[model samples]
Target: MINDSELILNADGSIYHLNLKPEDIADTIIFVGDPDRVPEVSKYFDDIEIRKGKREFITHTGHVNGKRLTVISTGIGTDNIDIVLNELDALLNFDFETRNLKSEIKSLDIIRIGTSGSIQGNIAMGTILASEYAIGFDTLMQYYQKPYNSKELEIQEAVIEKFHDLTFKPYVAHASERLLKKFAHDIPKGVTMTAPGFYGPQGRNLRSQNTYPHLIKQANTFKVNGYQITNLEMETAGIYALSNMLGHHAISINAILASRVNETFASNPKEIVDKAIRMVLDRL
Candidate 1:
C-alpha cells in the first residue's frame, strides 16, 4: 500500500492537486495550458457532465459525436506536467480505498492543444503544427528512469555537443506514433524545443540579460536524421516524456502565435488557437 503522504488524496477521495476523481475523466483527454481554454474546447461538447477546478487545474468532461472527451488545463510548464500526469495515472490505475495498483491498468489517449512560437523562418504565425519529437531543455526527465531510443539518443548527443556550454544535458522524447498519424497527417510535423521559461531559456532578452543569448539560433540550426527543431513551447516535452513513462499515448498540437525567428507576434492569436482546437476535435 502506498503511504498517505506519498499519494495524497482529498477528504472527498478525489486526487489532491487536480480535485478530480477517476469517474470524472474520460479515456481520451485534451490538455490546454490555460484554464480559460478548457471551456473553449469543452464548449463544442454536446453535453458536459462534470466541471471541476482547483488551482490551475480545470477539467471538463463531456461527449461529442458519441465519443467521450476530457479537457483539462495544466497551467504552464513541465513541473505542472509532473503533478498532473502522476495524479492522473494514480486516479486511473490505483484503487483509492486500497491505495494499491489495480489488476488491470489502462492507457489513456492524451492530446495537448496548446500555443507555441516558431523558431524556424518557414513556420509562419497561425500555422498549426504537431510535435513529432521534443527536446527538453528542462531537467524534469533527469529525475525519471527514462529509456531513450537510438534516434532520441543520437539527437540528444548532438544537442549536447552543440550546446556544450550549457549546465544541463537536454533529453529527447517523441509523441505517440498512433496519435501523431491519426490527427496530424495533413499538418506540418517537426521536433519541438521545450524551454524551461519564456525569457532567458527561450533566448528572449527584454529587461534581463540572457546567459545563452544564442539559444534560438543554436536550436534552429540543429538537425539530426532529417529532423530539425521547428518550434519552441513550454509543456510538450514534459507531456510526451511523462505520458511515455506512464504507458499513455500522447501528442501536442501547436497553434503558432509567435515567431521567434521573425520576431513577430500573431495579431489574431485566438483565431489560430480556435482553428487548432477545431482541427483536433474534428480528428478526434
Candidate 2:
C-alpha cells in the first residue's frame, strides 16, 4: 500500500514518477505524448532551467517570452495521465517531507499539445483544433466523486442510446474556459472525442472486422444540443477530468494529422506540428 509519505518522493528527493520537485516545475505546463517531442516543444524556450527523464517520461522546465513553463511527455493514454496529473498536483499542492497538505492549494494551468485526427470533413489536415469539450470512453472517471453535469449526462445517455452495442460506458466533460481564452485565437474550437485505442476502438481495420460497424460515422455526426464533434484523440478527457477534480485548469490543442472521412494525412505533418507548437508558445 502506498501511503502519503511513500507516494511523496524518490530516495534522491525528486518527484516519484516525474523525477521532479516543486522547484523543477513551473505554474504553466505543456504535455505531449512522445518523449522525443519534449525537446521539440522546449526549443522555443528562451532560458531552460532543467531537463530530466525517467523511463518514457521526459521533462524540460524553461522560460518563454518571460513566462515560465514546463513541458512533459506523458507516454500515452489515460493510465499515464492518472500518474502524471496526480503527481503534478501533489508537487504543487502538498508538502513532500511533512506529507501535510498546504492551506492554500496552488493550481496549475495545463495544456496538451498533441496530434489528432479530424472526424469532420470541414476540419481538414494541417489545421489546429482546440477542444471545447471532451467525451471520455475510458474508465478513469469511475473512481471520482465529482458531481456530473445534468446536461452532460443527458448527452451521454443520448450517445449511449444511439450506439448501445458498444461495451464501454460513455463519459463527457468540458475543458477549462480560462485556459481556452488564453490560446483561443491559435486554433479552431470544437468537441474532441477521446477513444480507447487508435485502431479498432477508433474504427480502423487490421485484417479483421470491428465491433461497431458505423462507429466512425456515428462519431462524426454526433452532436449534443447542436454541438458537432470535431477531432479524435486518446488523452484529453482524462486530463480534463483529473484536472477539474484537483482544481487545476486543463485544455488540449491538437494538430490535425489525419482525416477519418477522407482518409488523408497532412502532406507536411512535421511542418504542421511545428507551426502549432510555435503558435501556442508565442500565445502563452
lDDT scores for all predictions? 0.93, 0.86
Q: What are the per-residue Cα lDDT tens digits for candidate 1 across 191-259?
A: 999988988889988899888988899988988779899999999999998888889999999999999
RMSD per candidate (Å) reads 0.7, 1.8
**Cα lDDT tens digits for candidate 2, 1-284:** 33755476888877888999889999999999999999999988898899999998899999998999999999888889989999998888777777767889999999899999999999879988899888887788878765567766877787787768877787878788888888875568988888878888788998859888788899887777878779898999899878878888988999999999899888898898898898888888
lDDT at 137, model 2: 77
**Model 2, residue 188: what's the lDDT?**
86
TM-score between candidate 2 and the true structure: 0.95
**Which runs in model 2 stand beyond 4 Å of their true positions?**
1-8
Model 1 spans with C-alpha error above 4 angstroms: none
Positional deviation of residue 37's Cα in model 2 after best superposition, in angstroms? 0.8
Clashing pairs in model 2? Answer: none
* Location of the lowest summed lDDT over 10 successive residues in candidate 2: 1-10
Q: TM-scores of all models?
A: 0.99, 0.95
